[model samples]
Structures are given as structure tokens and as C-alpha cells.
Target: DADRNGFVMGEGAAVLVLEDLEHARARGADVYCEISGYATFGNAYHMTGLTKEGLEMARAIDTALDMAELDGSAIDYVNAHGSGTQQNDRHETAAVKRSLGAHAYATPMSSIKSMVGHSLGAIGSIELAACVLAMSHQVVPPTANYTTPDPECDL
Candidate 1:
């Protein structure tokens, strides 16, 4: 719940410790994994809504993979911001499949939105936390209220 009554706002913060592979190894730091690459893009079509084609989003994922020198098949998990909204879910699925091709279906993925609702600005970090927790526990969080699955969202 919000601390004040103006609007229901969720808030939190996260910090990650990162270093070069060799540096981490030399220190004997237990590394969870490496952040190979990342890409960001805006949906010019709409400020609050993502484009249905997901062309821009797909390109962003592709660019990240390319920069990481990794193939789509190498991805074991995808931490999607599954907002449970029609457009967002559909577009994200399309973008992922476009970037990962057939490997997208085989890879396990999940969204924390269903469990905690949208936390606005903190959503990304919360979702990342869910991913980290999943990795640590070796279990995927259930997509609560996910009934009558949409075929378009194969993941």
C-alpha cells in the first residue's frame, strides 16, 4: 500500500555487484552469472502502449545477444515483465520469439507481475529479483490468475 493517499505506489531499490570475470575469479567470489549485454528502446508508437509488431523490441533483444556474442539457444531463462495486459503480453511474446526463434519455446520464462502486480518504476528491479530467486531456488513462480491461456503467448 501507498504510504500516502494520493496514489497507490510501490517502491523499492536494488543494487548489483559486478566485475570482470577474471577479477571475480581471482577474489574467489561466488558468481551467480554474467550480464553479457543489455539494450533499451522506446515504443515510438505510443508512450504507454507497446507496438503490436514489436519490431523495435525484437531488435533490442537481437542487439543485446549480438553484443554478448551468444546465441538465442544459450539463454536458459527469460525474466519477462509480463504485465498480464493483452497488448503487453502479446507483444513481448512476439518480440521474444522473433529474437530467439524456435529456441524461445524451449526456454523457460516467467513474469512476476501476476504475483505482485505492476510496481511501476520498481517493476524491473522486482522482476529481476524474482529471476534471481528462481535461479537460487530452481523453481519458477506461478503466473497467478493465468487461466484460458492465449495461444499467441506460447511461453
Candidate 2:
């Protein structure tokens, strides 16, 4: 687990169709889920690297939770932006813990990038698709290829 280096430049694409809940119901469309909250942030800490403390990511998470009208305890799972780098993993763990408190430990968080590699533009859609599938099947995907857990990235 600690041997993480970097992600491969994978290639893929994904598409998600979002519509109003009322519109979906009126059209008799099967709605997978609704987006209750969303947030994004960046501190310009680095071009491609995140801050060591991951405060930026933590703030985003906390804000989204607040917008969703829920607390950390309401989270059943987490979709991480894990890039298979030491810094990314460690800081992400800290960020989740910071925003979610102890609930972060109990939550199932994983990065689809582990299995699909870093698809760059498409990885976001791919992982979101995975999350939808996870919810549909009521199963959590594992961080594939990982053996021993890293203490730093406890999530």
C-alpha cells in the first residue's frame, strides 16, 4: 500500500444525464439518484498537487454536507480522488477525517482510479458511473490491487 507511485494515463469516457426530479417522474424515467449537494474548491497550492494539510478538500466536503442538510453520520460512502500518490492518499485521509470526524473511519471510501488508472478527463465520469452502480447493487467497490493498508491513508 505504501508503495504507491503514480497512476497510468488511462483512456476512457463516461456520460451522465441529469434532469429535474419532477421532470424525470413526469416522463416516467428511472432516476438513479438525486444530487442533494455539491461543492468545489481550490487554493492554487500547486499546479497539480494538493496542499499538504488538505484543508481545501476538507472545506469543500464540509460545505457540501451542510448544503445537503446532513452531517457526517449521514454519509454511507465516499468517492475519493485518489491518485495513487503518497501525498494525495495521506492528505485525502486527513481531509475526510477532518470534515467527517470519526464517521470518516466508518465510511467506505475508495478511488476507482486504482482499477481504471488516471483517465484524466474521463476518470470523473467513470468513477461516478461506478458510484451509481454501487448504489444500484448496494455494494461498495474495493480499492483493487491493494494488499496491506497504509496507516497514513487509513480510509
Candidate 3:
């Protein structure tokens, strides 16, 4: 499993509803969790390649955490964008360790790309839905089929 290659392309669709806290409460709706924070940036270095330095992704993580007024220690889980490529795995690992620092070692991170295949535009929503379910159930999903440890992608 550690011997990575590429993601399995998939076709699917998912939808998630976003509701304000007060509005949901007013309607007696089930609130999953707060949206907290998110960040996005352009990796202009390459069209399809990412830097092993992971500076871009790390900065995005830092910005999101800052916006949420939370630190890496507050994170309970990480839904990694694990694309199964060697570069993606190492890059993601590096970014997480940089942004999360010591907490990265404690946080549980996984990717459902193997299970659901990489659904491209739909994968993000699907994964976000998984996060909400995980929060509701108080469970974190594991990286599927992982047997050997690739020290490069540790944590």
C-alpha cells in the first residue's frame, strides 16, 4: 500500500447543506458541526505537480487554523488529500507536520480515495460529508489497506 502510484478515477456526486447555527436552532434542525475555517490558494509552481517542500499547503493550513482561532492541537482528525502518488503523499505529510507541528503526530489522518476512488470535483464534498458523520459518530476512519509504513508519509 505504501508503494504508491496514482488515484483511481471515479464518477459520483454528493451534496451537503450549509445552515446557520441560529437558523438551524430556530427550526430544531440537527446541527452537525460548525464550518469553522477553510483556506484556498493557487500553487502556481506547476499545473499538476506540487512542491515537496509543501510550503503552499502549509500556509493554507496555517491560515485556516488562524481563521478558526484554533491550533493544530484542537484538530481531532485530518482528511488528507492523499492522491496515492509518491509526491502527493510526501508533500501532504510534510505540509501537515509543518502546520500541525507536534500535534500532527497525534492527529489521525486518512484518505478515502482508495475506497471511493478519486471523484475529482465531487470528492471534496463527499469527504466533507464524511467529516460531519465522523464528528457525529465520534469516530475517525482509517487509511484503507495500509499495511507497511512509509516513513516518508508518517502521520
Candidate 4:
């Protein structure tokens, strides 16, 4: 479990079959959803540390939303990068709130790592699969090991 202090390292692999909507539709492919937006930014502050205010992360998220032409209120779910470390959990929650404001609390966010354990660099693909599965099954996968809420991560 990843909720204790740090994540349990694990090994896994996932492959997402993506195609252009027109090509998929022509071939009768089952399209899940579209990747409407993407953005990236480097903090360059630390290899193992994040900014205290999480402004850089928030900026990246904001950029994504702007690219998608969507507002925070339009967000339905948040698939968080919850590494299960004290610093990461707190910082991620705070960053979401900073980016999405009151809508952050309205959105149901969860961490797949809590259930499947962390797979390091492979996590993003796995988490995206989790999101697609949740959408397909209409379920919000529980944060498996979560129990008490920390004051620092009051999301």
C-alpha cells in the first residue's frame, strides 16, 4: 500500500491504442475519448523537491485547461499523482485547489497508485488507463489505503 509513508514500488506495463478520430470512425474503432489538451512545464527547482506553493504545477494545469477551452467547473474527475509521500500528497492536493479553486473540492479525485502501487515512470500511462476504465465502467476507483485525512492535505 502507498498510504503509509511512501509508495510500494511495482512493475507493470500498459499500451494505449490511439488513433485519429476520423481514421477510427472509418474503421469502426471504439473510441474512448479525445485528448483535447496538453501542456508541460519544468520547475527546475529540484530533482526530488517541489515548490512550496505549487505554482508551477498549477500553471501547467491552467495552461492545459486553457488549451482545452474548458473552465475548472467543467472538470468532472481528477486523477491525481498521489505518490503517497507526505510531501507529494499535500502538495498535489494544494496544487489542485489552487488551480481549480472551489471546484477542486467538488471534483472526486483518487489515486490509482494506492491500489496498484507505484510503477515509477510507467504511472502516467497506467493512470490514463484507470481514467478510461472509470469512464467506461462509471466508477470512481477508491483510494484503497486511504483512511484518515491529513490536515496538510485537507482535500
| Residues forming the 10-long window of minimal summed lDDT in candidate 4 | 1-10
Model 1 spans with C-alpha error above 4 angstroms = 1-11
Q: List the global CA lDDT of all models.
A: 0.76, 0.87, 0.88, 0.84
Give per-residue CA lDDT, model 4, range 1-155, as digits (tens).
Answer: 22368888967978899888899999999888888988887778888788667787788889999999998888889888888888777778878899899999889998888888889889889899889989888898888878777777766
What CA RMSD would you report for each candidate? 5.2, 1.0, 1.0, 1.7
lDDT tens digits, residues 1-155, model 1? Answer: 11111222445666667799999999999887678888998766878788777788899999999999998998888887676667777788999999999999998887666566676877777777667778888887776655676777778
Candidate 1 has an lDDT of 0.76
Off by over 4 Å in 3: none
TM-score for each model: 0.82, 0.95, 0.96, 0.94
**What is the Å distance of residue 95 in model 3 from its true position?**
0.5
Question: Number of clashes in every candidate structure?
Answer: 0, 0, 0, 0
lDDT of 3: 0.88
Order the candidates by lDDT, highest first — what do you get?
3, 2, 4, 1
Which candidate ranks first by lDDT, i.e. highest? 3
**lDDT (Cα, tens digit) per residue for candidate 2, span 122-146:** 8888988889999999998878888
Clashing pairs in 1: none
